[model samples]
Every structure is written in structure tokens, then in C-alpha cells.
Target: MAIQRRGFIAAVGTGGAVGLAGCTGLGDDTGDSDNTGPEISGETLTLTTTTSTYDTGLLDELNAPFEDRYGVTVVTVAQGTGAALETARNGDSDVVMVHARSLEDEFMEDGFGVNRRDLMFNDFVIVGNSDDPAGVGGEEDIEAALTAIADAESEFVSRGDNSGTHTKELELWDAAGLTIEEFGEWYIDGGGGMGEILNQASMQEAYTLADRGTYLDMQDEIDLEIHVEGPVKDGPDELMNTYGIVAVNPAVHEHVNYDLAMAYIGYITSVEGQDIIESYTSAGEQLFFAEALSEDPEFQQYVPEGWGSSTDDE
Candidate 1:
């Protein structure tokens, strides 16, 4: 059974708010004659999303207008990307908003998700002590920066909870040809979320990977500085972090609320939702860049990144 919450905010309108799959120029009102879109049956939407969205407070802003327009309560569960997907796999969530594309691909491939759409994007940064103990400041290449950190044996904090940031950190280490198992006391497994990991790094004066939004939101409270920038600051493409929304496949879980899930997905990818995300800021700095309204979205927007070619080969 889905956990229910009543946070609905009634809006002043009698039109449809759901957006199309392609999501072009759609908002609260699409100027239709009847203005009555598909009937949504549910009153509560369970959204399992990553901690960065919740930590940066973007989720509340994004969900407010959505809840108001639909008159439905949005119960959000903020966890790691891995955990969020796992929750959906157990039929506990109606939709999932997350990063870490590789894990998302696995989930969709396993028939647990559908209608995956490119929602928004941000980048990950490598932060450490301001003194630059590893001497990796301003490094454009993430892999090279990781290699430098490893070579210096710098005390690095890892988000060992397998969050999106942790996934990116592991990928960077692998790209640099380094293994986590070989590391000694220099590596600290921070089995926590982004905010907790950032706080841990600050207390220990160690290095860690963090999303730009969370880092900026807590920048004043933490002593660490960004040693390597992400794509948001003209950094390498490897650091680019793209987020997507996937509706749990109703075929697998008959109890899932597919209509409400599609409505939520449509609204977020629509113009209004994109505007809300692009305008959101932490410490007066833009936290995310909207990607759904792009002129030419990749094939991966609706499916896995390489699903086409993989199917051709098979």
C-alpha cells in the first residue's frame, strides 16, 4: 500500500496541467476549448528522489506548483539514487526523479520503470581543504585530479551510501585506474547523504565529491573548497550530471498510479517546471540547468542511452 499524505494546495483554474511526452510549450493551461485534460484518479503522489534535490530545497519549490495545480499531495522520499530506485522496484513509489544514469538504465531494463525523460542537469565537483593539501585546485580533468589526490594520500571522504555523487566518484577513480579496495586509512567511507558527507569532510578537513547545488547551499557552513569544477563552471564533460524521471511500470506493479505519475513527469518537464528548476538558486547561484526543453533531446530521453544499438546487436 502507498503511504498517503495530504499536502494538496487547491489552485484557481479549471484546465489540464499535464504536459506531453515531448514537453513543448506546455504549462498549467494549454488554451484548449474544454480545458479539461485526462482525469487523474489519485489524490497522493509518492515521489522517491535523490537527496540533492531535497537538500537544496528545490523539491519543495518544484512540488508546490505541481501539487497546487493538481490538487494532490506529493509525498517525497529523499534518499540516494540507488535507494530511490530500489524503493520503486518494491512498488513503494509511483515515480522516481534521480541521477546516476547507469543505475536508472538497469532499473528500466529490468522492466521496473517506463517513460524515462531527460529532466534537468547539474555537475559534480571535487572539494577539499582550502589549503590544497593534494594540490589539485583548478584541475579541469576529474580523473587527473583523483590521481593527484590518491598520489598525495590525501584524506578523502567517500559517500559510501552509493548515492549519485558516490557513483560519479567511483567512476572517476576507475577512469584514473585506481581501486577503492587498495586505499588505506586515507579514505573515509561516509555512509551518509550529500549534506552529511560535506559536513564530515569539513570536520576532518578531508576531500570529497559533491553536487554543485548542495555544496553551494552549505558553502558558508563548510570549510572545504572546490578543487575541481564541474561542467556548470566550464569543467570537463565527465563531470556533467544529468537527472531523469522514470514512472514505475504499471505492468509489473498493478497497484502503481500510472496516470498521476505521468502527470507529475509531464509537469516537471514542461515549460513551467523547467523554468522553476532553471531559476532555482542556492546562495544566489543557479543550482540546476533545465534540459527537457532542449530543441533536440537524445534518444536516451525516453529509453536507456544505448538501448537502440544494443538491441540492434542482440
Candidate 2:
């Protein structure tokens, strides 16, 4: 049953309609024929998503199973979360997978997407040189950690590209209540992807914020150690990293394949999808922890339910 379901999902395709009336069976006059018309063919779905997931190679793993099951070709355009959201808003993609919740909410509220389902999650971690010059290691308080770094004039690399990681970094600084604007040279902005930023931080021996998945994937090449994690990584606001897959509203964009887009969304949020997410790991470490689609309290509160109240996950 699972294999058959997977096959059904992989064959789904999407395309723009000449008119909904002619394609959606609303205008069909055949009384003897089923309302469902011929299967959609040769349709392509464009997905605009975050670079972190792409850089970490998570999307490829997640999408491969779906593609094999659905027989549909998915074209992924990877960019920063901000750019991804903007692309979805501009109707350039049929679906969006991003991590910026507030921005995503605004997009949905504006009617660009029909629904946003909570996907998998991986927390951010503060990585720095092994020397630990800032003495931020094992620190659970993010604000104090940053303050120490600022006071020590420790080198800090930032993903200034408006990516989700960058957004989280800025929020951390804000929570620390330190004006990073005054600490000029100590801060470095790598206007590139997470991989590039990691390389830059390594080259400079600077501290930087990174998703756990990317850090784990590149751990061998990096001399940095996980300094701050959990709430301190993004502050006490749960600091949970939540990803959402949203279907571009067909009502707003005539070219979007609403049926196939929704189908993909449905598959991704289903139990099978969560199982796939849970199965991916790097060096024996889970890449992303699965989040149930149920209205669990922890999910509702931005923390994965049963994730424990501690700052670090076991």
C-alpha cells in the first residue's frame, strides 16, 4: 500500500489552465462521462525554497522519493528565505518551502497561499573556533553569550544575505540587547549561502550562526564547535525552526497547477512524508526531527511537543 501510494504521488503533474471552466470539469457537458477528465500530462511544478535546505542537500533527499512516486518533475529554485517568499508572492513558483514564519504568515494572510503546514525542524547552533575565545561554550543563555562575544571583540561571521539563518542571527542580537552596529570589525557579513558562510567563518576563525543540519554536514571541514544551542540559539521564543510548504493560490495565479500543487503539499504533510523526514540523517545524526501534523500543544507553542524543557535535546 505504501509503495502504491508513493507511485501515485510521484506521477502527479501540474500546468497552467487555458480556462478553469474547460479544465476543471465545470464546463463539461458529457452526461455519461465521469467528471474527472484525462490525467494531466507533461506538467512541471516550480518550487522556490530556501538555500539552507538545498545547501545541506536535504531537499534532494526529500524530493527524490516524492518524484519517484509521483512521476512529476520538480524544478527547485533555491534562494534565501526572503527571496523565496518574494518569489512566491510574485507568482514565480507553484509552491514554497521556507522557514520564516512571520513573513510566511503575512504572505498567507495576503492570500498568496492557501495554507501553511508545519514541516520538519532543525535548530540553529552557534559555531565558533575551537579556541572558544569568547568563552560562550556550554552557555544556554543566548543574550549573555552574545554579550561575551561582543565584550571580547570576538570575530563573528554573519549571513547578511537576508536568509532565514541571517534573520535568526539578527533576532539573537536583538535579544542580546547589544547594538552590533557599534562592533564593526568584530562582525563579518558573508553575503552568500550557508556553505559559503561556513567556509568564510572557518577561514576567519569567526563565530557564526548555522542550522544544525548544515553544521553537521560540514563538520569535518570546519574547526568550529557548537557554542550556543536551543533557545539561546534563537532566544526563548521557543527558538524552534519550523518549515512550511505552502501551495500558491491558483486564484491569484492562473498558471499555477493547483491540483498537483495541493497534492504535493498533502503528501509532504502526511504521515509518510514525516516518516521520510525522520529517516534522513548525517553521520548518524538526524538531519531533521519530524513534527506531527496534529494540533499538539508544543507545535502550537512553537516547540516540538515532548522535546523536553531543557535547552538541549537528547
Candidate 1: worst-modelled 10 consecutive residues by lDDT: 1-10
Over 4 Å off in model 1, which ranges? 1-42
**TM values, all candidates:** 0.88, 0.80
**Count of clashes, each model:** 0, 6
Error of 1 at 175 (Å): 0.6
* Segments in model 2 whose C-alpha atoms lie over 4 Å from true places: 1-38, 231-238, 295-314
lDDT tens digits, residue span 1-314, model 2: 01111111221132212222122432233454666653434467788988777877777877776666556778999998888988888889998998877677677768888656677677787889999999999886778888999999999998898778888788878887887678878898788888888989998999998888888888988887888776423443335566777788889998887766766676676556666677777888777766534443234322223335465554
| Model 1: how far residue 180 lies from native, Å | 0.6
Against the unseen true structure, what C-alpha lDDT does each candidate score?
0.84, 0.73
